[model samples]
Target: MTAPQQGSDAKSNDSSSFVTFSLAEETYAIDVLQVQEVLKVTEIAPVPGVPNYILGIINLRGDVVTVIDGRRRMGLPDQAPTDQSRIVIIDVDNQNVGILVDSVAEVVQIPSKSIDPAPAVGNDQSSRFILGVYSSSDGLTILISLEKLLSDEEWELVRNI
Candidate 1:
């Protein structure tokens, strides 16, 4: 959660830049400013006493970053890492954490007007984390809130680590 790239409210802007990524079979996005880096699937050192979503830790240069199994966090079925697998480093609160995504897609600029609330699609609980749906030339992209990626209790646990 680095202070510089705290996730902001996307609903308040006329236009927003999002870094899109793929998870499971769906496409998703987050504020571009919140993204610190995107890395390929790399070796992660496991941490004890953490939840299942935590894959492990990675030493980024000198900083130790906590890697999260984003699919698990979002309640999606787990799949083995492939060549397209990526670790998206996001800044939330004042710490930087890594979200393991299936693939890192292109960045997209979407107008706020084109974004709408998440629809009740088959009662998917993971949809709770989705902030809105952005309509683009390709299709609709689900926009997520990075700050809301982890719960308060989860944040506390990460802070302790």
Candidate 2:
């Protein structure tokens, strides 16, 4: 919850920067501007009666931030946290939320023209959150829309948590 990088320079007219991270062995990115800061996996105080995706809450400075398990949210199996695991605090719906990622890669700046629209695939709940895709030399990076990461009802539940 502390002010680290404001990410003011994460966007431009010709291109947009992204904060890339790994999840379920796949690469995913979020608009860099939405990223507040990254923190190492810490002791999470688990809450009862919440959904499985809600890993629990963390005492980030004086703020009680809800940490969501990215794997669970994406319908992927859960894995134990490793040394590379991190909590990526992102700006979602005007509030700071933490997304547990496998490992953070890097901040990549991709040209606007290079970004491709999300493919028209079968109706999948997770697919709705995909903003676009970027094929880089390393591989393809799935860009996600944090706003759609959760439904209005889900957001309300998180707020109540």
Among residues 3 or more apart in sequence or in different chains, the pairs in candidate 1 whose N, CA or C atoms overlap within 3 Å are 1-92, 1-94, 1-95, 1-96, 2-94, 2-95
* RMSD of candidates 1 onward, in order: 7.0, 6.5
Can you write out model 1's per-residue Cα lDDT over 8-107, one digit (the tens) per residue? 5645455778999999888999999999999998999999888888999999999999999888888889999999999999988778899999999888
The list of candidate 1 runs beyond 4 A from truth reads 1-13, 122-124
Residues 3-105 of candidate 2: C-alpha lDDT, one tens digit per residue? 4356544343367889999998999999999999999999999998787889999988999899999988877778999999999998877788899999999
Off by over 4 Å in 2: 1-13
**lDDT, each prediction:** 0.84, 0.87
**Top model by lDDT, which number?**
2
Q: Model 2 TM-score?
A: 0.88
lDDT of 1 at 115: 86
Error of 1 at 124 (Å): 6.1
Worst 10 residues of 1 by lDDT: 1-10
